[model samples]
Target: MLARVRSTNLAVPRPDPGAGRTTGIDKRPVDRIEVFRPGPRYGDGPGVVGDHVGDTRHHGGEQKAVYAFSREELDWWEGELGRGLPDGMYGENLTTEGLDLESLLVNQRVRVGDEVVLEVSVPRTPCATFQRHMGERAWVRRFTERGRCGTYLRVAVPGTVRPGDPLEVLEPPAHDVDLRTAFAAAMGDDRAARSVVDAGCLPTIYHERLARHLAGEG
Candidate 1:
């Protein structure tokens, strides 16, 4: 089956007393969104024009311009949590289908619709805000252990994206550092961390973290 966007979502303002004054974790489906490369998280917010990104310190930037989660993974979460996980429940901008996000290698490129091209940059890391959003006990731990964290994309070619847009996943990169491995590395797996560092092509922040990990500093 061809990969496709099941839904496009934009943030809905909600109070988050923990980190940012407000949270954009509650995203609702939208008809369409214009994708672009927002330079950095501190100033340039979400790539999807008009989407809210309350926590700029860690989210939304050129490397994390877009976040995508697959329906298959959501289904698995639904079964695990014994609750319905609607599209965008995980704060992803695009709810995709027919894609094994975990298997996608870092730097892999995907064409959305007819114009926009996104490069897989990194895997989403679970934070306190995410745990609070899910309202599940030990949500972070569960998510980390699963190692099915969604993929964050960099807008290589900007354009409009809408529901049902066909996703054309391009060929894999030379390295074999898939999202699963990356996620594991982020969660402190020594071997996975080495693999990610060896693969290279990661964002600078990740490189720094990997370096620290290798040096027994992280």
Candidate 2:
């Protein structure tokens, strides 16, 4: 019903491998972020005031405009891994509390404080970059198996955002497909993949890959 952003994070753009790539996945920290209602073309675009993304092609765009992870989930990982995970550890631009990000359905719309409106698009697929960021062996596999991959959002309205800003769901999708479903689909759950495609709210960047998975082509 109500959620708040615990922190906002961004990276300093680096060549090939980004500066955020730490042997421990330590990312740059920030207190607040300017949320472009129409969010930038991507994390590196003009709309975003100060954030930098390493791989524009894969990291940021309209559909994958922003990445959000749950503070609660991060805490869970802290307990499981017996280590502290601060905000932005997963390269998430927004660290949220009081929302079940993993269960967020595609097409769900959220209003941040009063300025920004965001549409849930898809689940962030864990990658080698993430593994290297965390410096954990089998990190990708463990993340996938846990099924708590965070959600990406498309900007529908632009406004500046800050830590402690409230996030309210403006709309919820009619379908069952959600972040977990998308992650499961990517992890070889044919039924879940088909469900994601059928929901038809997935971002364009993810379309081809998920479609192939659904069709047994990939």
Candidate 3:
């Protein structure tokens, strides 16, 4: 199977009754999207133009400019949950096919179609918003245990991306810290956390978290 984008998704606002907040977790497929580096999570918004990001505190920014998930993983979840999980159901901007997202190293670059270049930055951490979105009991714990958290990307080269665009993964960085290891780190694996910190390719948040964890403050 060739690596390509099965769909491009944009946020669809939904009311989070649990938290009394609006969430953009309900994403739906779109024909096309403009991709760019949206500087900081606080001031700037989603890297995909016209996309809505309700929770700026935790999501959106240069490091999380885009989110990509594999269709294979979605299929696995569909069977596990006994329901049809469509493309973009997991709030990913790009529903990709035939890519091992977990194997992608931090700082690895991939070109989408002919234009956009994105760098693998981090793994999508399951959070309260995601749990509420799924509405499954202990969804966060289940997702974390599964450890197929998908990948978050930072826009390196701005351009337009559309459905069916081919994905060209560039050479990986020297570090061996892949998304799986990073996800494990996020899940409190001290060894994995140390590996990610040693890689030194990810955003500062990971470093700070590791520091807090070591200090027994996290």
- List the RMSD of every prediction in angstroms: 1.1, 3.2, 1.1
The residue-by-residue lDDT of candidate 3 on 48-153, one tens digit each, is: 9989888878888888889999999999999999999999999999999999999999899999999989999889989898998888999999999999999989
Ranking by TM-score: 1, 3, 2
Clashes of each: 0, 5, 0
lDDT of each: 0.90, 0.76, 0.89
The global Cα lDDT (0 to 1) of model 1 is 0.90
lDDT over C-alpha atoms for residue 11 of model 1: 91
Model 1 ranges off by over 4 Å: none
| Better structure of 2 and 3 per lDDT | 3
Q: What's model 3's overall lDDT? A: 0.89
lDDT of 1 at 14: 92
Ranking by lDDT: 1, 3, 2
